[model samples]
Target: MVISRRGLLQAGIGWLPWRAMPRLTMQLDWHLNAQFAGLCVAESLGYYRRAGLVVNLKAAEPAMDVVQTVVAQPQTLGCAEESLILTAQSEGIDIVAIAAMLQASPLALMSLPQQSLTHPRQLIGKRIGVHSDGRKAVELVLYSHNIDPQQLDLVDIPYDKKYQRLSQGEFDAVQCYALDEPIEFAQRSGQVPTVLPLKDYGFDAYSQVIFAPTSLVMDQPQNIQHFLSATFAGWRWAIEHPSTTANLLVEQYVEPDYQNIAYQQASLEILADYVLPKDAPRLGIIDARRWHESAKQLQQAGLIAALPPMAMSVNDNLWP
Candidate 1:
């Protein structure tokens, strides 16, 4: 999962150390890649430093849950999937969303060309591999298409082996992010796989959101606001200079797999669509419309028992 899982953003947020030079830890649910290029660029360009903050970029393992991490450490700002936020709320965990980087979620299903699975309805009787955390979304996608999830054969699989399983003909399709897996699969197998993005089938949710414990939002509103502004500024600059940003990412933070400047560039270019749409006024602006809609979608998916308190879940006041 790319917690940078999408949000095209990351690398910045609120909560500064009160003394002379402020410092904060930004827990990224996923590892370093182009998904967080905007954030990495902010540090690369010293945006956070100029704002009087030292942002520590921490990467997470596949099993590290950002929700619980933030809950355990209230002082840090964490990047996470929005659905997890709603799920946390259902479980009595209160986290406030300050801003979202990936406005349109990149969650998708990928299949080999031979399978030719392009639509949700095509999955009937097919064996599809699902990421452990992605089951609810898969179910919601099927429900949105007016198909019963029981009609398909769903298998739980590990993230690292999903694509390989698909290639071996063990499965027809596998859950993936629209931008991440597709490019990776193509580069690895030398073939373009068919993709079905969940947003197209009615399972749209925010992908990359900066979240903090309840007390942090209430206690440090001004610091959070300033951190968000710096983050948004970094996103703006990254969006405007995709090539330079990609290069910087490869030179600095990106891991070995994403060290390819071309690959990082491709990811950043595709993420442009998710980070900020054509008509978006600015980067990192969280809206209530998508917020409520996503909550409803989660309920329909049976991922959450009841809708979380919408008014308190997102920190809209953080924006200017």
Candidate 2:
């Protein structure tokens, strides 16, 4: 049975059929959108079912702490940025990243033509509206360009309302998803915005990471393996068929005005670049070097006290 809020709170693993197969729940870091195309495709195409598993896919809510939820709930999984996993790990949260979904982070700093902030250094003396969760990323970007964080004006904007404020001139720039806000703004305003992608600015990190309680990894290795294989296979299919997957995302998952189809397609195409970059070893392979670099960037930015043990932060063997 599909697990909703009420169902998840009440249902127990004992509620499953008396088979030994494991029942699991997956929590996404954000709301349903093209970003979750792979998981949605996996669900719609019966990949999860074929693996002899029952899964509950939970969409994100405001102020929802996904990692903490995984820690609090048993037999559950979560997807979030590796930076968050690292930070939580440093704070003594026992979690291990199993697979890297997006090869590069889509987090970006966006501004319209009037702002004319062409370079990262130009951010100084300007107000940048950012989500509190994204402060570390924005910090890394500023420091990478030798710009001191104190030199810029940072106003915390609710993640949901950033675009509205940026459009109304409340912010000279805002942190947002490259695939999402830029396209949405262009579609609405007919003017392309300047997008400074964090990855290009040396804030590279894997995004939409699949992570689980270390207990879950050790206790249910086979279940995790099956889930990864099927999930990555679903991603492969989604990447190969962006338009088809986008249609499924809008119709069955998050409904949008039919006119938004073009915007959806554009977002999917941009996501494909991050999900399947040139010479990527495989669709869902996590780069050990990139992870190390990500950790180093976080440490330099003072987000984490220091680098957590690599073995503790990631366990990529499960993906293969």
Candidate 3:
């Protein structure tokens, strides 16, 4: 199964009662966590309110398909991996990307630093834990390294158990979101795991992107733009003040006792590398060339039959 089948994100943060406010439901690509702090902060800080909108941020479940949800409810907007956007288009899902949430892909291979599993080639005979949705990326990494994926011992592990099992030596290495899982394990355990980002090995693809049905783009262009503007502002603020954002998140949005505020700050700090790279175009702006290249990578991994046609793959004009 692809990551789309494994999990998606959403969080029903809050809703305003005003009859005139445009209420939009946002479907996230994965469960709520520090990764979605910007969205949560946007709501808490009144960024959405200032935009004349009331957004319902819905957290995704392992069984729910974001594309299906967005398709069934065209008025809704959703976030997911860039490859999913291409795949959805190939399958006739008609979704258009609004902006890239993570400018750099966060997909990574993690292992104990002592194992020396620092490079893709080192895993030829080693057992590597992978999420069902992560198979294509693992394969792409292998191919990029001139190693056949068949040479690697790939084990399909559930998302929640990948790190735990890795710590127990169940897997020599495991795939994970570079920004979140490694920090999570480091916080829980004194040991820090070594990470080999797939992007470093040429399997880069956008991790989280905000998108909506094509009809929504055409019918309510202003709403989509407003949401993006407010979202970008929220992310800028979140990155600048992770500690404060984390506190706000735990207080109202995230589970107060379940998620530690400090841990949330740590994850967001690491995420700055992806969310706001040193010299990117700007926050939430999609790079057209990278978008096309990602489609090619998807095709190379055999996840998609072919690269999506330019017309169907991206709308560069959507962001500005």
Candidate 4:
């Protein structure tokens, strides 16, 4: 008998039975951008279905409230910045990071060629654009380099407008994912925006964490493990065969955009440095020390009131 992904998940996680195992839904934090290329690969490659998960990939609205949405649907899992998870947990939301979809923070500051802002400290006195969700990451980066947020003016700009605004000189720089906007802008204008990576500045935080309610994890540990294991395998595969994965993304998910395929392939190569660290356990391994350090940095930057104990937020069973 061929067992379905859901059946295996139910068996592994000790769900009541195949009939009792409910379908799982996931909420992503953004549009179908390259940052989520692995998810696209997983979906196209049959990873989610093989794991018995029925994922509903929703379009994220500008005003979407991530915490409220997750709280309302207790069984639903939501992906967002790790700082948001810490913020939610600090507010007693009971969310735990089950798997880290992105092992490194993608947040960075991008500047036009004329500005030549090569370092975080140089961002002082410049008009910076950042999404409200990205404020904590930017603050952490600034704090790590001893740059005072008060010295700089922050403009709350929608992510879509960031590159254009920068091109038009609306802001001196914009905080965005190194993997997406900078590449997109460069492709469109043939001018590569200078990027200052936050991780390089010691404000290391996890981006794109896969999180669900604490009760859900406690009740279905094995299911969570299976989901993460397959998900990690999907990422590893995506990284190994980026062109093929990008082709899958363009073909299966939507009409082929050859430009996007090229962009995604490049982004995947750059992401390899972030996702797979040498001497670490392996790809997608969630480190407790890294989590604690990130939480502490957020606290120090005043993004969170307090750091939740590392034991409370990170679950290591997802790592192979």
Candidate 5:
């Protein structure tokens, strides 16, 4: 009697199966920002192929809700700020941060030099034009200086119009990234925006964390390892050869503007300083104390209902 396909599979139960392997598609949050440029570089440079992953680095649009997207597509791994992941976790989302692209936060408050607002306390009673989602940065700065959020008047400002609003005296300061608006403002307008870095103000949250559902981590730990290893190697190469990396970004990832190339290169160097500390063992190692401290501050500021226990938030296994 001829054995049916199912019977043949059962007959050779101890042998290897011939099922087709499933393809994985990871959905990251954004495009070629300084933090994500390394990922793009890795893809273009074939580092992911070397690591046995077929990564498709798609750009996330502004309207896309990453958390919802990740939840909807079980096969896709999502990446974004660690705080966002923490917030999702607090709300019972099953996502976990796998690796950090930036060991330190890059968020900052940018102001005109003429404003001369050197301290956080100086922000009190000022009309601050911050992106609506910048409450965290504002709260962190206020808490660091023992100022109440109620003291400052927060006006919602669109990011594209921030420079114009500040120039027109519509707002005293704007929440921005050290790499983007500050560099653009300085280059185009010859006005150096003073940056009050979040780290210096006791808000040491990690930025650009690699995240995926907890189920994915449990089922495919090797895939996570391979993705991070290649990604980190790409970062190492970018940090060491910023000019070449910037050129790659301009040619492959962005419009070929000479000024944009210069801006991106300088921004990448600054980001490198933040990603790999001089004394740190590896590039993406999370500082637990800093993580806890940031959570505590966020808790005190009433940002989240309660801080998740430290154990659930950070993974020490990510270290090289």
Candidate 6:
């Protein structure tokens, strides 16, 4: 059957005889792009169907709060950075991270060549545009460099239009996906930007961390297990076949600013570095140490009321 958005949303790819399988939905935290290559490949290639699941991929809308969006429908798993997930859990949300696709979050600060922003310390005296949601993460980068948050000028910028503003000289820098934005920013504006990934600093946290309601984890363990196994397998395949997965992403799940196939491939290759880093234990494996470290940092930054329990933040046993 032809897998259109109609079919994928209304039903599964090959769901006629498998109609009774567990139906699930994933609420993405941002627009669909190569960043979600694994899930895109998994859904388009019917990996979910083969694993007895009917999954719908929901692309994020502007101002969409992924945590509350999924919480409203507990059956829907959400993909977001672990920092936001930790904040939610600290505030009494019952979400548990099941798997981390990105061992290092690609969030970073980008600057024009003239600014010559070579290191985190260079950000101290300049005005950087930051979204409200990313303020904490950016602050952590500053603090890690022994620089005070107030030492730099951080003006709130719209996430969608940051590149436009940055290119227009509205600010010295903007928070962006180091892998995704620098490509398009360079292509469109014709000026290569300096991308400083947060991980290059001490702000280590997992991204694309998939989490579900803790109750859902306890209730539908098998269904969750099937989803994770197939999803990670899809990731391994995507990492190995970056070009193929990039094609799928460009064709099926492309965003307005991310239409170029070459750009998508570049983004996917950069994503592979984060997903399967040299020292990574394995793709899609959540590290207990990272979760703990992220939670503590979030607490220290006053982003969360207190550090949430490890069990509440991650389900380390569901990696199979």
lDDT of 2 by residue, 1-320 (tens): 01132332243323335266567889988877878788888888988777667777888888888899889999999998778888987788888877778988888889988786767888989999887567888888888888888998987778766667778888999888887878877777787888888888777788888999989988876667667766877788888898888778877887453336667677788889888899777677776667777888888777799776563323243333
The model with the greater lDDT, 1 or 3, is 1
- Candidate 5: the clashing residue pairs are none
Minimal lDDT window, size 10, model 3:
1-10
Where does candidate 1 clash, by residue pair? 2-5, 7-102, 7-208
TM-score of the candidate numbered 1? 0.89
After aligning candidate 5 to the native by TM-score, how far in Å is the CA of 102 from where it should be?
1.2
Ranking by TM-score: 6, 1, 2, 3, 4, 5
Identify the runs in model 2 with alpha carbons over 4 angstroms from their true place. Answer: 1-21, 255-259, 311-320
Local distance difference test scores for all models: 0.78, 0.77, 0.76, 0.73, 0.70, 0.80
Point out the higher-scoring one by TM-score: 4 or 6.
Answer: 6
Stretches > 4 Å off in candidate 1: 1-19, 311-320
TM-score of 3: 0.88
Candidate number with greatest lDDT: 6
* Candidate 3 Cα misplacement greater than 4 A, ranges: 1-17, 256-258, 311-320
Give per-residue lDDT, candidate 5, residue 294: 68
Which stretches of candidate 5 lie above 4 Å from their native place?
1-26, 255-259, 309-320
TM-scores of the candidates in the order shown:
0.89, 0.88, 0.88, 0.87, 0.85, 0.90
lDDT, ranked from best to worst: 6, 1, 2, 3, 4, 5
Query: RMSD per prediction, one decimal?
Result: 5.6, 6.5, 6.8, 4.4, 7.8, 6.1
Worst 10 residues of 6 by lDDT: 1-10
Report the lDDT tens digits of candidate 1 across residue range 184-230: 89999997999988888877777788888878878865556556766
- True lDDT of residue 68, candidate 5: 70
Query: lDDT tens digits, residues 121-223, model 4?
Result: 7988999998877888888888888888998998778766667789999999888788777887888778888988887888677778888877887876656
